[model samples]
Structures are given as structure tokens and as C-alpha cells.
Target: MQTIWLTEAEWFAILRIGLGLWWLESWRHKDKKDWFAGGGIRWASGIADKHRWPFVRRGFDLVVKPRPRLMAYIVAYAELALGLGLVVGFLTPIALTASLVLSLIYLVLMIHDWAEQGQNLMMALISAVGLFGASWRSWALDDTFGLFLQ
Candidate 1:
């Protein structure tokens, strides 16, 4: 293989780290006070209410609407945690999988919004690539701690 400045593993690690930074950026841009006060969840609920899919509306009302505050906290903190985990490679596979799931959920919920769907699609793709590449093996703490390495 033609090598660059870094080995293949290192490059993959960089990709993983970049994705982690994206998650961090997502978390950083949120207004925590308003999000914690249920503003974010309320906004999502409003979208769900108007969604063309009946399943989206019913599922949200059943799972999120009844607990707006809790869901808000979950969504906000989950981003932070996933970002930290991925950046440090503390739990790369878990972080990548969780991010994939979250991205898929976001993709589905915002299917009507073409603009936001792009980010969701990219996140999901990156998560899958990083997970399959074992990106943590190079610059990740997972390697140092010997976590999930056969």
C-alpha cells in the first residue's frame, strides 16, 4: 500500500477523531439552559406532531412526549458523552454504534428536511467506517488500555 504521512490506522484514527469533533460541535452549539428546560424536546415534538408519518407521531408521543424533560437531557448529554468517548477512544465501538443509531434516528425524524439530512447521513457513514476500520487502534486510548482488542 502507498503510505502517506501516517499509517492507515493513524488515518482512520484521525477520521474517528474528526467525527468526534463533529459531535462535540453539535453539543457545543446547543443552548443548554433552554434544552434542559424542555425547549429542544418541545421543538422535536412539534416536528413529530406535524410529520407525515403516523408512526413518527405515535412513537414520539408514546416515548418522548410523555417525558419531555428527561428526553431533552438524554439527547443533550448523549452527544457530549459520545463525543468524549470517540475522541479519546475510550470506548470506540460503543461510541460509534451509539452515534450511528442516533444519526439514524435523526435522519428518520428529519426526513422532510433535506438540509439536515446531509449531516445525519454523513455521521452514520463515518460511524460505520470508523467502527469497521477499528480506528481506535492507532491514536485511541482503547489500544493503550487494551480494551476490546483480541
Candidate 2:
């Protein structure tokens, strides 16, 4: 068996780029015009209906419930901020944390509504947390100057 060694810097860079791109890709996919085929509202409403956390779900529904067009815009913009923040490494720790939090929320929603896909969402949430350390440095400007974890 052959062995390959990578320094902390290398490992950090790899994880940062990989996870950043993952976030960016997710945001891009969700931003597509026909992403939900005009069903985004129904889909969000359905998830709201199945939620076990009443307060949180109700809050989500209130924000995403009134007008779906507005909901879509809010969702898309939130994702865009998350994605760009991750990719740019401007606020690496905060970005990664937000990603993890959002992933966990989605995981719960998926589990409540689509049990079969719960595992996938769970895995994503786990991966997001796992990559947190790496997400702190490397490709980020924070790494370049030491502003990240402070």
C-alpha cells in the first residue's frame, strides 16, 4: 500500500474548497427558475404541515406561507448568501455554522416528510459539521490574514 501525506494547510484547503463548492452547488440548484416546477410553495407547505416542532414550523410557515413568491425569493436569497459566504471564505466559521444549521433543519424536514430521504439529508448534515475545522482556514481570506476564528 502506498501512503500519501498532506500538511494541515493542504488538508484545510481541500476541505474548504470542497465544502464551499458543495454549498455553492446546492444554492445554484435551488435557484433554478423551474427548480420546483411551480410547486415550491406546496412543498414548503407540506413540510410545514408535517413538522413536529410546532413553534419553529409555525414560524417557518408564517414566513414562507403568506406569499409563495416572496417565500421563494427569501429562500433563494438566503441560500445565495450562505453559498457566497462559504465560497468567498469571508466569514468561514459563521458560514460553516449556518450551513450546518440549515442542513440540520432540512434534514428534519426531510425526515418528517420524506422518510426515505432522511438518511441522505442526515449524512449531509454530518458532513457539514465534520468539515467545520477545515472550513475555517485555507482558501479563505481569513487564512490569508488570520481573521477567521477570532
TM-score of 1: 0.96
Candidate 1 C-alpha lDDT tens digits along 1-150: 336888888888888999999999999999999999999998998899999999999999999999999998899989999999999998899999999999999999999989899899999999999999999888889999989772
TM per candidate: 0.96, 0.71
Kindly list the per-residue Cα lDDT of model 2 for residues 1-150, writing each as its tens digit. Answer: 122576565565566556666666766766357544446667767777877788757877677677777667666666677667666677777766776777776666666557646544653654465365565555677678788553
- Please state every model's RMSD to the true fold in angstroms: 1.2, 4.1
RMSD of 1: 1.2
- Using lDDT as the measure, which candidate wins? 1
Worst 10 residues of 2 by lDDT: 118-127
Number of colliding residue pairs in each model: 0, 0
Model 2 stretches with alpha carbons more than 4 Å out: 1-4, 34-38, 52-57, 113-134
